[model samples]
Target: MDTEQQSQTKSEFEREPVPKSALLGFKSFIGMYAGEHCAGTELMLGPLFVAAGVSAFDLIIGLLLGNALAVLSWMFMCAPIATRSRLTLYYQLEKICGRKLVILYNLANGVMFCFLAGAMVTVSATALGVWFRFKMPGLNDLYPNSVGWVVAVAVAGGLIAIVAAYGYQTVAKFANIAAPWMVLVFLVFGFVGLRQFIEATGTEIGSLSDVWHLAKTQIWKGGPPQEGQVKFTFWHVTFFAWFCNMAMHIGMSDLSVFRFARKSWYGVASGAGMYVGHFMAWISASILYAYQLHLNPADTDVLPGPLAYRAAGLVGLLCVIIAGWTTANPTIYRAGLAFQALSPKSSRFKVTLITGAIATIAGMFPAIAMKLLGFVALYGLVLMPMGAVIFVDFWLIRKFGMQSYYAELSGKTFNWAAGLAWFVTLAIAWVLVKFAGVQIFFVSLPGWFVAAILYIVLSKFYQKKLRPDAVQ
Candidate 1:
């Protein structure tokens, strides 16, 4: 086949392994990651650090360590497996977890992605709220409060969905175009916010040390959390930074994204996103929020639209909308893939549109976006066990004298071992979070180990009993 035909074939190859001829260069991934990670959500997350009462040292040091760990997880844990298999996470899961079990996982993953996209839709809609002068939901609001809010979300969500339905290359292209400008705008938010803070406090800045001192005293001053926020420590900041994208990295969702890469080392491209989006964008956003609080403590609403507008006027407002779009496009695309896995013969474009509609509806509810910190933590926890299952199945199952891809090898409709590992691990996580007083943020780390161990032990008994004679 010609290169064009091969590229087209690869784009539509949902069930089959991606051909080597269709693999993408490292630059494609870098652009995608930078654009996707430097997202609308950073607007929410940065302000959230201020609300959580994080100190400067804790937030900075924590993010550095956490983001580094996150990049490493992508490189070592996810990318290698993706390059070797050249299949979507759904397809790979189907081999080990079986068709029925994979359907459940895909549903869980799809719903979560939809909600995440919905949150981004909400962020973008807030930008509209600024332009239209509408009443937006507050930090504690659970539902849409006004007709304008609903319309804004609907319009933004519709456009974003259309872009996402065009597929990954389009998504990457859009991200590449927007990423550089969005990053610059985010930096402006920081500089503008710092100037505002300095002017307000009459603080004279002479060097980097002065800025650090200002950041410590004025921006991320350590104290009690705002109303309805969890107190943030260094560990909380670190873990939140690391595991915030746990579903993508540690949970193996990015297996789909990385499968198109020319090399496993392309995973390192994730550093662009981690540093630019998760680090710089986050800090800049936090500065903006801190300045807002400095101006009016009672204006506690965490709206990215108005916040950006206060700093850079119309350009900032435009940044909020595009930032949200860049993030949501890829997210909705991922969700579409998850849903498509359930009905392999279905039209991807149509499925993606439907998924986008669901996300738009969910976006009308403000609670998901308002409670995003907890929500994202829960999102990762819910999906992380399967990652452990995938890890163990791919690397360890054979070493333990059991057949890998047990479901595929045995032609089973469901693999009880993988299923139990997923379900039981969640159960354990729930127990730890509910009764053991463990915070949700910290539970997934130990839970990953639990899932891995459970998968290994359960697979042993399962393979022995079901296929004793076929044991390798």
Candidate 2:
């Protein structure tokens, strides 16, 4: 590609509102959410819950409530403003925060995206390891086991990156096609795994009540957490399910996604992902893990490729690979937009390619992906405060008689109030986790409120002191 083409920022619009012509139908969102949620991460995450020592009731009931909350967060917290403003999260933040502050936030956002995409690459590479009979990362492993594993990840990352570099249109198309098939495969994994458990154990099952009994006794039997895993109670499961994608919905990163919607109600389409991916897929994947435990009783490895391969043979491996690709493509694409925002003059495609390379390198280290439960929570927490900033600036600021987009109106290159609120909320959250003994999952919701209140209050004093005439 020519330098001009390479440097083009095709979709990361920094100034203009998205045109009405680009609005997508609700079904487009359904397909996107379904594909993104019922993905490679589900394979890894399902097993992690099993390690967390959750009972059947906690898992089932918690997920029902959690998934409902997640969908509502999208519909109420993210979608309305996204459709009204029709701007990418980066551009929107740049308007509220100064360009300099937004740049730093974008860097953090991009890095998180790279790491997340890296984890997906790792999940898919496991399938390649199964196919080629090469060494793969094992449970508790921190690094790539062999050269073959690295090669597999690099190959997968390269293809996924190229697809992402093409932009969101292609990514959505790929996901729309993959989501239904992957969901079907995931269901099969659960059913086949359940049958194996029944046959191998000779468990009597004549009715739904019998199945519930088996679930409590054998499948989701609650006990001490596995080594290094925390015990998850009903509340923990509920909160984790709701906030698993906290950064995207409540954190407002999905502003970019929902900006294309024809109406705010299209945000309700997120229910497709929440119910299908987080609820059903999560439960099914957990069942597979439960069956694995039944078989060996000692093997604690959480290898998705091997688990699936054992269940449905090669079809399972293919599901792992496809699921990873579908998730990683859009993630890398978003990461590229963040990077490109740092250098608006640069080519988005080249930026995305670089982001993909970073993800590929991170994928070589298996520790983060294996401990994905905690890592995902941390990543979401990091980006979440900014979402609060956006929310306050958009709706609450004017009501509070504070200037919205003060930085943009003042021609300031940095907004201290927004920046301070962003970091201080995180620091306070960290203190709660470290000193106050609050869990990571529990801190995010309060952290968001802390950020919103801090931003508004600080903006009042800071603006009055710095720009008295500007404050209403």
Candidate 3:
């Protein structure tokens, strides 16, 4: 090559650092979504839907519509931005929101991600408890059930944390390898569960109506939530389906993942996760739970390990264990990325290890995973505003005659407008939830709108005072 061409190539490589690009094709995401979404937590979340009194129609229809919305959000909103920027969410946020704002955001994002992973760890450990013959907790049980349970959780958490610390490539590879097996097991579990239910109830289904009748009567019966559980209605199911992954979709966290897509159409790949993991797996798990409840109406433990073991023997148990790890591995990797952004001096590997340690501790408390439905809603709400800021700033700011990435351009230590917009919007949303008694599930959408509007207004005013040179 000519000297000029070589110089240009070297400069390009230096400016844009290259990380491993082991994730290729739609299959990687297919495995990831299926493996990550059809997880041990599904065993918990699906039962919670039943406990929340979601009717058959609402759960089925709402998931279809809501998951479609999530897919669209990724396609139109997140992927375009990600492919254009090709940076992790933290780095992108740092450029626009500045170091001070991103530090706070990263801390919150990392903690929430860790806690979420910890919950997955908790889910897997419950399965291990069955093999160890230790006492396990019920749906209402929040604290650790036994010393053996705690030890199992610790061991599982440590293994998952180590894998996560190795970084994103390993996490994706692990998911891709485990996903197909897990998906098959979940499907088999569903079929076996339905057969068991049919035998017990002596019901025969030959039509759609029959399935619906059976689902309402024997599966997801619309009843009052169990003790300490919140009631759910049609709206609750709809909103929960939409916002459960609010961080990834509405919050734009998937900007990191989608950034690598060869085309925006790759966003459609998310459907693999939503339908298989969230929809089919969720329903399958609920079937298992319903059967469990039918066998012993008084039993309320929603542990996936025991549920799967009862349904499909050792294979089911192994599915839960591997599925939980597959999900938690990526989650912990994302958490590590968030934390690593806080200290640029720290190696990503070391920071990830430390982040995993935090996740392991959080896993020790089953409350996070056990109360996952509510916790997921809250976690999504917390991180979503910054996502809104990124979204509005990237697409809308230039149209409004304001500079994008103003923090980097102006050399500002902190961008008050971005920081204040996130906090103020969240504060208002919190007031609506706590003081006005609004449902938590509905807060994220409105909060996103509030953040978007506030950022535009704040950016206009904040930029007006800058010197002529700073405007560039």
Candidate 4:
């Protein structure tokens, strides 16, 4: 190929506008979701269910019902909008919410994305520490346990950031490559852990009741949370499963990913992630934890690196490292885009590097990963409001006889309706959590509805006053 042709091909592959042809078949999404969800972090998140004292029915049935709702939301709500607009969430927000509002959204979105990526960095570093025999943190341990852990995290973070800096194509390619192997590893971890559990208990698998009894007595026994941990009930598990990725699904952040899909059905592919990563992988990882508890009941520290290394040896260790990268890469890329929107002139690659650096720094602090449950819930609540605004603006605005993308059309720098809706919804959700004693998991759903209602009301009022002729 000529120089120009080579450059075009490289650009096409790198930023690839995701052709309608490549928008996706169901299989592509299935693979992507399965791989993306069944990652190393599952090792951490799954065990937390055990810590939270979920009963067998609650853990199994709740995840099934909750994850199904999440998938349906993506298909019915998120994907249709994405297919129609074919724009990144950031760009879409710019049109509806305006540049000023988007800048604030991007900051919040970018910072949250960075913290999430940092947790993945922590996951991969755990594997590195295992390989090098570095000291790892315990469950309650918040600070770095050793210098070796720090260096491992730095090296792993640097590598993940570099992959992310290359942009979306690289992140997607890496995910595609690593996802299959990671899924197998998660499967192996589950199977091996189950065998170990069966052997430890000397229980014969004769009937469903036997399994139920074992699960209740042995596995996810409903009990008080560990010290320094909040108690979790069935509602907590149900809502957490539903809104853990509230920003992506309900908040419409995945518009960037789903915009490439040829049809909305591709949103159904998220079911793979929900079931494989969140459901299956979680159960598997919890099995690992149950085994660990059986072996050492007093041990509170749960690290994926050591856990995997013990189960599948070198292969398991590698899975931990690469699995963490696969998950973090796209996250950092998304974060980079958020930051880049702040300064459209700045190079996305450079901004991504800076974002990666921030993530690396955050990764050094184990507390973020250690508190993954609460952190994930909080992040979703914070970002879900803007998603609600986008949803309402795209689908509901026309019905109200108001213009969609009002900011772009009116040439407004800030859309007070979008801004107030987002902030006010979050403030109300915060109040619910603090004063009303509502569980954090359930807050986002109500918060999203509040934001939607607020956006429509505020938009109608603001537009009527500002552009009276524009309102029907």
Per lDDT, the best of the predicted structures is: 1
What's model 4's lDDT at 343?
A: 90
Please give the RMSD to the true structure for each candidate, in Å: 2.9, 3.9, 4.6, 3.8
- Model 1, 153-259: lDDT tens per residue? 99999988887887656766666677789999999999999999999999999999998999999999989988888999999999998999998889998998888
lDDT, candidate 2, equals: 0.85
Query: Residue 395 of candidate 3: its Cα lDDT?
Result: 91
By TM-score, the better pick of 3 and 4 is: 4
By lDDT, highest first, what's the ranking? 1, 2, 4, 3
Name the TM-score of candidate 3: 0.90
Worst 10 residues of 1 by lDDT: 1-10
TM-score of each: 0.92, 0.91, 0.90, 0.90
lDDT of 2 at 275: 90
Residues 1-472, candidate 2, lDDT per residue (tens digit)?
Answer: 1212212422435467777765667777886677678878999998889888899999999999988999999999999999999887877887788889988998898899899999999888888888788888766788888899889999988888887887656666667677788899999988998888888878888999988888898899989878778888999888899888989998998997887777998888999889999988988888888888888878887878888899989999999988888888878887887888888999988998999999988988988788898888898899889989999999999898878888877767788999999999999999999999898989998999999999998998877533556555
Q: Tens-digit lDDT track for model 4 on 1-472?
A: 1223323533453323445543455665676566667765787888887777677778888888889988988998899998888777777888887889889988898899899999999999988877688788777777887899889888999988887787556666666767777888899998888778788899999988887788878888778876667777777888888888888899897887787677898999999899988998888888888778878888766788888887889998888888888888888887887888789999888998989999998898888887888999999999899888999999898899888988877778799999999889989988998999987888888888899999999998887533445444
Question: Number of backbone collisions per candidate, in order?
Answer: 0, 1, 0, 1
Q: Please identify model 3 stretches exceeding 4 Å from their true place.
A: 1-32, 84-87, 163-172, 346-350, 465-472
Task: Please report, in order, the local distance difference test score of every candidate based on alpha carbons.
Answer: 0.89, 0.85, 0.81, 0.82
lDDT of 4 at 220: 80
Look at candidate 1 and tell me the lDDT of residue 25.
Answer: 84
Residue 151 of model 2 has an lDDT of: 93
Return whichever of 1 and 3 wins on TM-score.
1
Off by over 4 Å in 2: 1-14, 18-23, 162-172, 347-349, 465-472
Model 1 TM: 0.92
Model 3 Cα RMSD, 1 decimal: 4.6
